[model samples]
Target: MKKINEITEILGDDTSYYLDHVSKKIPKERLQIPGPESVDNFRESDRSPQVLKNLAQLYNHGNLGGTGYINILPIDQGIEHSAAFSFYKNQDYFDPENIVKLAVEAGCNGVASTFGALALHSRKYAHKIPFVVKINHNELLTYPNKYDQISYGTVKEAWNLGATAIGATIYFGSKQSNRQIQEIAEAFEEAHQLGMATILWCYTRNSEFKTDSDDYHSAADLTGQANHIGVTIKADIIKQKLPTNNFGFREVDFAKYDEEMYESLTTDHPIDLCRLQVANCYMGKIGLINSGGGSKGESDYKEAVRTAIINKRAGGSGLIMGRKAFQRPLKEGVDILESVQSVYLNDKITVA
Candidate 1:
């Protein structure tokens, strides 16, 4: 897709409209992010104009609808699981370049990764695809902590390294969630200022809500709330785990979710749930995308694609898939990506 000067186009010389819109839309609390002053002075020098230009390429491929579903292939397994557990068993899965290639070849909206991986491949394949630099991460293999750290190159640095968007994970239920919110807000604001978009991984954890899907209302409400927070903070695309029928909220009635009720929302199998999610996004007035959990079997992966397509048809923004694509052999991964793209963009499906 051709790139347009969206920044200038959106806010023309009549700056009052931009100022008024921003002031009314974003809450003051939402805008309360610590600026560069909070960071040590030593790191400030790198936040240069030249650096931001390079980073904008990572997330913005300038495709899809001007603002469409962002089918992102995220492979941060090395930080989430043991390196060997994630990639060593199949060395083919360890190469970041292979993952990026799969995303591009398969027609993904973009690929998200840590700085090292993006820096290595952006220049060689910059024209081939768009990239998103994951600015914050937490390793599960490490000693457990209340929350994760932003152990990455700065957002400005990531743009300089050639990223179009930036990804940040926030554990909403964590004890340190407030700090994470502040951190992400700062990055989100900065990224937008530089004419780039932001994708937020809004996960819920360390709360009363368990991982079980059968819980019904509680889980749905929890995920919905997390998504709400992301939207409230002005995320362009908010990503969350696929919610189960379970509801984490007591007021929700799980048994009421019958086939007739489901059919009322849309024709897709999970259309009811997807519609509910879309409703939540509509209520919050933002785009919601679901994440592809870890690697799964073929059937499971296909089902995931089916679910994603359902979400899209039900008014979803797109997907943020990871291990499912990257864990496979590179070629197979690329094929899986293409299949997903075909399903998402073209609405072609063979799955039952």
Candidate 2:
């Protein structure tokens, strides 16, 4: 694939590590990876028929459709990062219709955003592309902002807006985590009963997650556990950040884990670390989709392609990237989203 070589050129010296085959700590053969037949796997589970139908609509649209890999555009930052700050790069996004239009033009499988974003334009665009309404957000307007996630709207509200899925975030390690978990679990239950799918932004948040030398929030072991927890809550899809390193527990001298977790089950390799994320999703019974972090200007396209390659090779699902696409001009944003979708559509790129 030409895109593979493009990734090599973009990564430069880091190319070999990103391209290496992952150790068999978690065999790709045993993983239920994304594909045209992936929707069949859900029928065997407890998901309702209507849930299955909505999932089919999600998987069978846009450029990456039927391949089972999903490319979603999440734009809920209005509340999370504030409307003015998030839309500063491109004020066009201030109008919710532009957000949905961008996803459609870019051939994305779905568009995810705040409740009001999808609700206001529901009648016009909901049927054209699957809508994933983020059910909760932590408004930055709070004085001395907190890491907590609170419901911005109800799951039924999202369903009434014609959304196919409901999304929520749980800061898995924060002090208020238990309450967030209970809230999201209850919301997901209501969503499923309402015939909507569920996706969780499984993230770790703790002051101790960082050190002067390394940030352990993206640690393989830690994020992997978050994926397990997300699946336990019956999240139909788990959205996580790509693993950057391992040894979060050992280095932080915190959390509960075993030595073999690092000794035999994992290494410092990016793909292996990501494989651990897939492994924790009950060996791929639940899909693991990585988030595209904030944009990096000229490097956004390359980084987006790089992450898609890593996620696909690691036997995980695709990406739900935002800022990378939304922060730029509309055409450039479409280019960024399509660049990542190219990786998933190319048959030449196989699972590691």
Find the candidate with the highest TM-score and give its number: 2
Model 2 scores a TM of: 0.96
Top candidate by lDDT? 2
Give Cα distance to truth, residue 9, candidate 1, Å: 45
Q: In candidate 2, which residue ranges exceed 4 Å CA deviation?
A: 1-16
List the global CA lDDT of all models.
Answer: 0.59, 0.89
How do the predictions measure up, each by TM-score?
A: 0.71, 0.96
lDDT of 1 by residue, 1-352 (tens): 1112322232346323222221112222322121112112113433445334433343234233223445678887777665788886467656778767777766676778888888887888656677778888885655564446565668788778767778889887677788989989888888877756677888876635543444432255566667777866767667777766534554333223454533343332243444455555543235567877766665544555555655554456667777777766766676665555544444221111
Colliding residue pairs in candidate 2: none
lDDT of 2 by residue, 1-352 (tens): 2366665676788766666666677778888888898778788888999999998999899988889899999999988888898999999999999999999999999999999889999999999999999999876877887898988888889989999999999998999999999999999999999999999999999988999889999999899999999999999999999999998988989868778768777676777888899999988778889998998788787788889888998888899999999998998889888888888987767788
